[model samples]
Target: MINANKTLSLAIMSGKGGVGKTNLSLNLSYALNTGGNSLLLMDCDLGLANLDVLLGISPESNMQDLLTSGAKPSDIVIPIEQGKKFDILPAASGVPELVEMDEDMQDLLFSKITELVGGYQYLVLDLGAGINGTVLSFAAMTQMRIVVITPEPTSLTDSYALIKVLHSQHNVSDFNIVVNQATNEKEARETFNRLNMACEKFLNIKLKNMGYVRYDPAVTEAVRRQIPFIKYAPKSEASRDILNIAVKIQKIRMENMGRLSERPVMKKFPTLDD
Candidate 1:
């Protein structure tokens, strides 16, 4: 059983769609779980929820049910990997209104989320791509914000745009970058360096290169098989890359915990409008 305490919340977001944000989120959750930490992966892509689709499970309840029916958070959570590891809060797909939940509603939902995930060690939010009010709000609330990008020019442009928006609007300075689907480490470093230089020159923000995942055919095969690449092809290069990233995340958390002992106070959760 997970200890009831403050859970480390992480939002995995991307500047544009099809950058493998959701796939990375799922695999990262599995990697964290394999390390013996309980986690909750929330599908925050409200309108097009498909984390369940990836796992090949059908959820009877979703975020809409929790909102409309006043369902207990536990009632809506579904366990995966035989209930021994990760739990998921599925979202209703094709519900356009859910994509733009107001500030009060978002706050209310997160309060419930805080309660529901308090026992777990981490809550991973798989946010929708692009910069929108909903995405900004959720990303601002989390302790760690991971921005996924690729080597494509469009991906790089949109990612820098996202960082600028978050920084200027929400005062979010610290950001972790993950390069996905890179052909090689050289390509990955080149991508990160380009983005890093841009952010430093323009936004004056330091972006950390969390790590990069190599493009692998096994990722597509895992998707087709409806299993996470980490599980489907544990020996694949992409899986190993994700595991390394997960380790870095764990190390970051530990270092933050040590710092917290000195500070002994938590930062206020940023309001959606703030």
Candidate 2:
């Protein structure tokens, strides 16, 4: 289904690697796609992309192909299935220069993205770690930004650092936090609250608690089996948590749309009641 005015681009980011960024992106995209929303899960990790690996397919060409050869967005799209839900998009292989694509290439990337967005309700960009050019650019370009962090002290500190970088470099004030790999609901809530507190106190920015994912062995098994954990173990804790996260995201988008609908439009009176 094509929608010219309904695309919501969300960039998934992390302060550091090994924080389950790719896994969250995959599962969340799958869960969001469940309600008949056209989703495009792009591996904007640029160099060292692995979303395709999680989905169990190696594309002949990826984002690099579209960037260099003028390939259409549809040319490299790959489908992924998580039980009954699915989405499609181009993956990024370990291309050395993509992490630092030049301004010309960046413009081309955005142009291609515009073409792809016409058909997707949501475009989930799975970005790489840190505040490098790649991650920062994706975060800046996307309409929604979700930062993934765990309960570890280092993770919290680095997440703050990431927020500081985005605010300083890109002027991105709004952010959402996802507490990944939490042990329990209480732990997740506490972790998210602490981070939100820190952001409010220090950065003067309000960070929304997007949702959390519980730690589960099925995550590793799914990685080993080259499938999303939600599909690999639907009844697992992680899968259920991801489903809940998706619901929260849906509600947020719906609320945002509702607010837009409430806006007053300036109407022009007909000249002569034609």
Against the correct fold, how does model 1 do in TM-score? 0.93
Instruction: At residue 66, give the lDDT of candidate 1.
Output: 81
Pairs with backbone N, CA or C atoms under 3 Å apart (clashes), candidate 2: none
- The 10-residue segment of model 1 with minimum total lDDT is 264-273
Clashes of 1: 0
TM-score each candidate.
0.93, 0.89
Task: Score candidate 1 by lDDT.
Answer: 0.86
Where model 1 places Cα greater than 4 Å from the true spot, the runs are: 1-5, 258-274
Candidates' lDDT values, in order? Answer: 0.86, 0.78
The predictions' CA RMSDs to the true structure, in order, are: 3.4, 6.7
**Candidate topping TM-score:** 1
Query: After TM-score superposition, what is the CA distance of residue 265 in candidate 1 from its true location, in Å?
Result: 12
Candidate 1 lDDT over 38-106, as tens digits, reads 899999999989899899999999999887788889999998866566799999999988899898778
Clashing pairs in 1: none
